[model samples]
Target: MIRFDRVTFTYDGCARPALRDVELTVDEGELCLVAGRTGVGKSTLLGAVNGLVPHFTGGHLQGEVSVDGLATHTLPPQELAHVVGRVGQDPLSGFVTDTVEEELAYTMEQLAIEPKVMRKRVEETLDLLGIADLRHRALRTLSGGQQQRVAIGSVLTAHPRVLVLDEPTSALDPTAAEEVLAAVTRLVHDLGTTVLVAEHRMERVLQYADRLVHVGDDGRVREGSPAALMRDCDVAPPVVRLGRLAGWDPLPLSVRDARRAARALRDRLGDAAPDEPPATGGEAALTARRVRVTYGDTVAVRDVDVVLESGHVTALMGRNGSGKSSLLWALQGSGSRRSGTVSVQGRDPGDVPARVARGLVGLVPQTASDLLYLERVEQECAQADAESGAAPGTCRGLLDALAPGVPADRHPRDLSEGQQLALVLAVQLTSAPGVVLLDEPTRGLDYHAKEAFALLVRRLAAEGRAVVVATHDVEFVARAADRVTVMAEGEVVADGATADIVVSSPAFAPQVAKVLAPGRWLTVEQVDRALAGAAAGEPA
Candidate 1:
């Protein structure tokens, strides 16, 4: 259904090709997962399917890319709209309408489909992706995850033969991610749709993928079965990593397969478990009393009271539209707070100037790119250093640590989603604030990038800075967080130690924790350490 014949694409200013000599084919009704490291041309490859590469993006193309035997170079995106539907990383950028229902129907209206058929497909898509409640909500009022589902629904309503999704589940919570993936699988299985998805969170989609197209650092692409490629794939889910760690044959791609293979390994380290770290017991870095945020008649946060310690990492988790972003914005003191008091270091950040608030609490919002306005990466870094009164190269240093090797001269807009996120995080961290808040920081980051970011979060806490990350990446929370706070319907539902909060919930548990059930393991690293200690005859 889709074919890339010796396709090589290079952006206007880049010295090297983003994708070079990529020959690949996707059979009809196949779910092909495109996997790679951050900024390694995964999006570039996906954009080529519908003529967005050389045509719209102004890049040089060497060979041909075709969908349904029609060359993309000959047919523009508008002409290919009937056969190919594309959803980008940032969903809000593609939205044209004001409400969820209108956005979903806009595509069909453009395609000039029958009104009755369009209405039927719109309703089916709303139910398929589980967004029936959001049909009447304003696009701007919805949460990031909700907007993402709407974006996908808008495309799915068109009923294109080939669906190309870029990080389709990046903004979704665990259950929402499952629902979206299940819907995509159904499209491939029941409806014979050809789907190509490029995602950073492979744990959610790897099990359902029929083929894996891995884009390596050298701009080359390799295609194979999930199990065949996972054996040596650098970017992999925790389940695959765990299978490699245990030397399991045909590395398990799902939690069930890993759990079935883990019985003997579980016996080897009998009664051995990870040691729980003691609480930080540090002074309160920030205190919020009676915080409330509302939008018209909708209350986003309702009289929430919480304390952030001086040296700790807190993971704020919830489903889509659960007020995680609203609460984070309120705590940062920049966003709207209908009624509340936020105290940071004995001062109310809400009453202070924006500059003062930065020193008190720095925030990397859900749309991290909104914070970046400079032309080049180095310029942004330099400006961040000057604005925060930090030493030279401080922001750039942080960027290198978070996501290394980003070109200094590249435009911030030109950088990949993960790189853009890292740049914004670096800009925020340069202020050296006592408290840091990151909303969906790992949205575009791969497994290695997430590990590096988790380390950075730990380093920030170690430096006596309190950090709160609002995210749906359970694997990241399992590795990075000391405390977990789960919110639902604009209220705090559960808050406790990381192990206590995540392990008990099926929707939020990490892959390792699910595989080694009856054992309170939260990450593959913990299991690795416990097994090594047991091998050394050390105390449990």
Candidate 2:
């Protein structure tokens, strides 16, 4: 149903082609997953399938690309809208209407379908994606995950045969991610709709993929079965790594298979679970008492009291609308706090100048690129230095440490989502604030980038800086966060050490923990250490 013949695409001034000599095919009703690290042109490849690459993005193209017997070169995106449905990384970017229902139906209206048919499709899609409750809500009011589902439903309503999704589950909680993936599975199996997805979170979608299309860092493509591609890939799920570490003959992609395969390994390391990461040890770096925030009639955050200690990393986790983002904003003193007192280093951040407040407490929002407006990375770093009154290379140094090898001359907008996040984080860290709050910091990051980011978070905590991250990545929280704080419906429902919180909550447990249940092993690294010590005949 989809074919790419020697396709090569290059941007206006880029030295190398974004995608070079790509040749692949996706049969009908197949779910082909595009796997690669950030900045590896996975998005560019997806755009080519729907004719958005050279047409909408204004890039140079070579060779042929066709979907459903329609050549994208001849049929522009508008002409191919009936056959292709594309959902981007940011759902809000493609929104054309105010409410979910309207957005879902607008595409059919543009395609000039019958009103009755459009309405029927809209209703079916709402139910299909389990988003009927959000039909009346304005797009802006919905949480990030809700917006993602609505974005997907809006495209699905068109009833296109080919669905192209980029980072569909990046911002979603575990439950929401499962729902979206299940819906996609139904589309592929029940409806014969073909899906071409590009995602960095392999653990969420790998099991659903029928085939794997890997784009390497050198602009090359390799297509194979999921197991064959994943065994040696630089980026892999924790289960795959666990298999490799345990010397399993074949890696297990899902938790069920991993658990079944882990019986023998479990007996070898009998009940020797490692201790959880140490808690923060310094004095309280920030404190919030009776914090409350409201939007019109909606109470987003309600009387939440919290303390963040220096030299610790706290992960704020919950459902999409659980007020994680709002609480973080209010604590940073950037957003409105209806009735609360937030003290950073014995003073309220809102009392200081905006420039001074940033130095006291820095924030990297969910959309990390919003903090960047400069033309180049160098300009952004220079501006950060000026704003923070730090050394000239302070921010650049932080960027290199967090994500190495980002070109200073490149535009911040031109960077990949992961690189943009790293740049924003670097800009925030230059201020040398006592506390750092990052919302969804690892959104588009691959395994390697996430590892680098986790190390950076640990380094900051060790340097006596309080760190807080609001994210949905359970693996990330297990690896990086010292403490876990779970919120629900505008209140702090659970707060404790990471292991205690994640292990008890089924929704938040990482893959390793799920495999080794009734035990406290949270990560593959912990298991590996235990085994190594056991091999050396030492008590684990």
Candidate 3:
């Protein structure tokens, strides 16, 4: 259904070709997952399907890309709207309607479908994506994950033959991500829709993918089955990594397969207990008492009381719309708080100036690009250094450590989602705030990038800074976080050690923990260490 014939595309002002001599084909009714490192042209490849590359993005194209036998080189995006539907990384930027129901119906209206058919499709899509409860909510009022579901539903309502999704589950919680993926699989299985999705979180989609299209660093693409490609792919899920570590032939792609192969390894473990996270003993870096955040009649956070300790990493986790973002914003002293008292270093951040707040607490919000305004990356880094009284190149150094190879002259807006996140993190960390808050920081990061970011978070905590990351990436939480705080319906539901909380919950457990059940293992590194110790005839 989709074909790329020796297609090569290069953006204006860049000598390196984003895609070079890419020849690929996607059969009808197949689900193809595009995998690659951050800023490695996964999005560029997806954009080519509907003529968004050379036509709208003003890039040079060689060769041709076609969908349903129609050449995209000759047809514009508008001309192929009936056959192709796309959902981008940032859902809010693509929204045109105010309410959830309206957004879902807008595409069908544009396609000139019958009103009855549009209404039916709208209801089906709402149910399919499990967004029936959000139909009447305003788009701006919904959480990021909710907005993402709405964005996908809007495109699905059009019933396009080929669905192109960019990070479709990036913003969703574990259960919600499963629901969205399930819906897409149904489309492929029952309705014969062709799907091409580029996602950073491979764990969620790898099991469902019929084919894997991996984009390498040299602008080359490799295509194979998931099990065949994951064996040696640099970017892979936790389960696949665990399979490789255990030397299991035909690397497992799902938790079930990994668990089945782990019986002998579990025997070898033989009651070796995983090391517990070190207990936090530092003084309180920030304290919140009776914090409440409301939007009109809806209460986002309700009288929440919590304490953040210096030299610790706390992961704030829960289902989507569970008040994680709202609570983080309230604590940062920038987002709306109907009634609350936040104390950072014995000073109320909300009462102080923005400059003072930066010293007290630094926040990398869900929309990291919103924090960037400068024309160039180097300028933003320099400004951050000057404003924070830090040495020049401090922010740039941090960016290099977190996600390397970002061009100095590139526009912050033009960077990929993961690169934008790294830049925002570098900008915020330059202030040397006592407390740091990151909301969905791993949205666009691949496995390797996430490993670097996890180390950076640990380094920040080691420097006597308290860090709180509000995220849905369970795998990341397992690797980076020392403590876990689960929220539900605007209230803290569970708060404790990371292993205890994540290992017990089925919805939030990482792949390794699921495979090594009956043990409190949270990450592959932990298991690796235990096995190594056992091999050396020492206590694991």
Candidate 4:
């Protein structure tokens, strides 16, 4: 259904081609996964599926990209819309209508579909996505997960031959991701609709993928079965890593496969307590009492009391629209708080000046790029230094420490999603606030980038800083969080040590925990460390 022949695309003014001589093909109804390091050519390749690369993005393309029998080189995106339904990283950016129901019908309306057919498809999609209840809700008021579901529904209503999705499940909780993926799989299986997806959360999508497409930093592409590619792929889910560690004959892609092969390894651990996060010390840097955030009649956060201490990383996990973001925003003092008393370093952030508030607590929003506005990376860093009254190179130094080799002169918009996130985080750290809050810091990060971020978070905690992250990436929360706080319907449902919380709950647990069930394993790193310690303890 989709084909790329000797395709090479270079964005305007870039020395290196974003995609170099890429050759790939997807048969009808196949679900292909595109995986790579952050800033690699994954997104670039996805854009080429529906002619968005050269047509919309102003890039130079060499060679042919054909969907079905039509050459994408000659066809613009609108012409390909009937054959290729493309959804981008930020669905909200493309939304034209205000409500969920209208948004789903917008694409069909643009395509000039008959009103009767459009109405039937919209309702069917609402049922398919299990979002029938949210049909009347405003899009602006929906949670990240709800917006994502609505976006997928909007495209599915088109009933296009091939579906192109970029990070479709990044904003979802485990249950919601499952629902969305199931819906997509139904399309692929029942309707023979082809899907080409680009996602950083490999664990969530690996099992459902019919084939794997790995896009390297060099812009090369490798395609194969999931089992074959994951055997040696640099970026893999926790289950694949666990299989490698246990010396399984065939590396497992799913938790069920790993668990079936893990009896011996589980016996080796022999009921040993799983590794725990480093102990937290120092007084509370922030405290909240009866925090309640409401929008109209909807209570996003309700009567929640929480404490964040220095030298600890707290992860906030919940379903989409579960009040995680609202709680964090309220605690940071910038978002709406219907009734709450939040004290960061003994001062209310709402009462303090913007400059003073920033010095007390720094927040990196979900779209980290929203924090950057300057033309160049260096300019953004310099402005951050000036605003925070730090040395001229202070922010630049921090950026280098976090993400090395970023082009100083490159526009913030030009950098890849992960690189932009690193830049935003550096800007937030300029003031060296006592507490730092991040919303989905690992959304677009590859495994290697997440490893670096995990290290950075640990170092921040070691330096006696308080960090709270609201995220949907469970694997990341397993590795980086000292504690986990689970939210639901705008309330604090559960909060405790990471192992006690994540391992006990199936929905929020990581791949390692699911595979090594009956054990409190939270991460592959912890299992690796335990195995290494056991091996080292043998007398020579």
Candidate 5:
């Protein structure tokens, strides 16, 4: 349905080609996953499919690209809109209509699709995407994840044969990402529609992809079955790490396979150790008791209670608008708390003055640039350090820690979204607060950056700091977080160790858990390793 023939594309005035001599194809109904490091032209490749490259983006294009038999370069965006539907990484930028229902039907109406047909399509899409309840809600009032679902629903309603989504779930939480991916899978499976998705959170979509296309930094492309590519390439799911150790052929793509592999390995290791009690720890670094935050008559957070201790990575898990952000803000005193008691280092967060509260808590807001207004990153951190009374050199060290190998003199706004996020995190960490709150820190990052961020988080936790992350990436939570808390409808629904929470709670678990039951590890590599170990001592 889609093909790129020896395509080489470069931005206008840029010396290097974003994509070079790339040849690829997506068969009818094929679900292809496109992945690479950030700025590797993954988004550029998607643009080539729907005439956005040479036409909209004003780039130099060479070689032929076709979609469903029509040459993309020959057609304008309007001409290709019927055959291809594109969803971008930023949810806020894609919205065209004010309300959810209206957004879903706008594309169909523009195409002169019959009113009756548009209504039926809108209803069906709302149900399929599980947003029937949001029909009357304004797009601006919805959570980031809800807006994303609405964006995708709007595109799918156009009835495009091919769907091109660029980091569609990057802004969403785990449950929301799963919701969108599940909808995409159903479209391909039930309707036989083709899907081309570019996402950094590989663990969520890798197992579902019929094929994996890895775009290299050198402008090369590798295409094959997901399992084959994961086993052979430098880039693979986290479970592949365990697969490499277990000696599984074609490495397990889903969790169930990893479980089988784990069982065999564990048997070989001779398990059956006696159970032991969890060790005791010191006082919690931060504690919230029956917390409640309200905006006028609406209660954003309700009767929530949780404790974050020093030396632990606690993942604040939940769907969008489930009170994660409100709780974080209230605890930091940046946002109001109607009724609740939050303590940071034995001091009441509610009683503290707003300016003083900031010195006690470091927060990385969902929007990466929220707290930043400086020209250069180095100057930003240095200024923060001076205000916080930390050594200037210490602040630079923290900046380097967050965005290693990147120049400090560069403007934060000039960097990629992921880099900008890292700079924000670096700025937050430099304040030397006892507790840290990261809201969707992994958004817009590639897999490599995700892994690196996880390692950095672990390091922070090891330093006896209390770290709390409000995020949607389950695999990330599994890898870096020591514990997990699941939220729904502004309440704390579940809380426990990351492994326990995912294995025991369906809502907080990744889609991989549905395939690989029992002890649910977040990453493909972790599952692979556990499987290999479990395979031990089992008869061949």
Candidate 6:
């Protein structure tokens, strides 16, 4: 069992405590979910469990934190490693070896285990995580999802009684997220290991959590079962949102449960007819004709021909290293486009002046918030808007659209990762350019914020502002994308309507696709419509 007793932590140089008077617990063999926006003491709490908070972090820690009857304050992280197997949010942070199999074995070797035992354990964990195929792969070559899995697998090889994972799926695509969660579920059910996970993607973890612990920015911890707690929390899952809208008894936690309630609501209230598809043949906001980009001797994007229609959302969908980012940069005129033409409203992106391009296209790069150097959120937005030639008050209006009630005085750097992303989005969108490019906009967001972001993207598209997102978030693609483009090895391999391409293509299909009756079932709405159609056709 792990317990925190009124724990408050302050970094050595900081004025504020990262965590304040937090109390939480995880029972033996229990699966507990630690949830909140990013930087809300979730990572700190995980570090505290492993003695990395005050010990390695050199922080002023008050109160007690214990793991398995051992006080973490008294034990060094290395000493506590025997009981705690931690997979940090940053996959690179916990690595000790260069290869997948070797990384799995490294911890056992550190514990002075027999080589034969280490090898057996490594093999078992690789097979357990369904990563035996990647056993010989170099750590650097693996996709973010694969790297995260290897990180988790490496620790699991130690067979530690307690496993703490921090946002293990942040970098994963939807299918890959499912694979990781499946393995984690197996660990709790089959191995009887106690599991504690910190994540923003709550929907992916909700079904597995025996208990939910919500951590506030002030470091207050609230613990209860997922059903009871998330039902009341404002930032709950879409299924919860549907439940709230439909007025269901005993709020549903999963999509499957929510579907039944939705069907019942449809029976009582009558399903709303589907809206007509938006008009086609608007002016092309952005176009890439046979676009190719190469890095040194290697090609990153090859002959990718595509067009982003004005006022539509186009999602670039593919696995990591599939040239999604390359395509986005090419469209935004940030990367070199060789052997092809990229145009924004008939103007060549490469030949157009930077100031002219700024008016035509705005890009929110992946980790774009890292570019923020401002002290306050509002000032940062205003400064970006002014520099971009946007009219005054545009930034404030954009912020109001993104987050209506958020305080502008809050430090931009101090905001949660999700909030920071929204802030950058406001800065970019305030210019109201012909096209907006978002690279992995939903990458680090939790289930609640992801749903909100999806809504926002749709709203932008509806306003006749072309929006393009390069992301592996299949769930978001299903909800927000009008078109899906699949890239592999720096080439455009597939492009079509979101539902048709993702559901029909085996490689790019999300995990939810596997369960749904195929034929363009992408979003929950699509699934519902499909079910409704089937029901209407059946003899009653």
Kindly report which residue stretches of model 2 are placed more than 4 angstroms away from their true locations once superposed: 389-392
The C-alpha lDDT values of all candidates are 0.90, 0.89, 0.91, 0.87, 0.78, 0.76
Using TM-score as the measure, name the better of candidate 2 and candidate 6. Answer: 2
Tens digit per residue, CA lDDT, model 3, 378-452: 999999999889999999999998788999999999898889998998898888689999999998898888999
- Which residue pairs in candidate 2 have backbone atoms (N, alpha carbon, C) closer than 3 angstroms, thus clashing? none
Per-residue lDDT tens digits for candidate 5, residues 143-171, read 87788888888988988899999988887
Candidate 6 residue-wise lDDT, 249-284, digit = tens: 788877677656555654532433432245352678
Taking all chains together, the TM-score of candidate 2 against the true structure is 0.97
4 against 6, candidate with superior TM-score:
4
Q: lDDT: which is higher, 3 or 4?
A: 3
Ranking by TM-score: 2, 3, 1, 4, 5, 6
Candidate 4 residue lDDT tens string, 67-134? 99999889889898888998878889989989999999988998999999998998899988778999
RMSDs, each prediction? Answer: 1.8, 1.6, 1.7, 2.0, 4.2, 4.8
Model 4: lDDT equals 0.87
**Model 2 over residues 116-221: C-alpha lDDT tens digits?**
9998998999888888988899999887778888888887887889999999999889988887788889889999999999999899999889999999887789
TM-score-better candidate, 2 vs 5? 2
Give lDDT: candidate 5, residue 209: 96
Please report, as a residue range, the 10-residue window in candidate 1 with the lowest summed lDDT: 273-282
TM-scores vs. true structure, each candidate: 0.96, 0.97, 0.96, 0.95, 0.85, 0.82
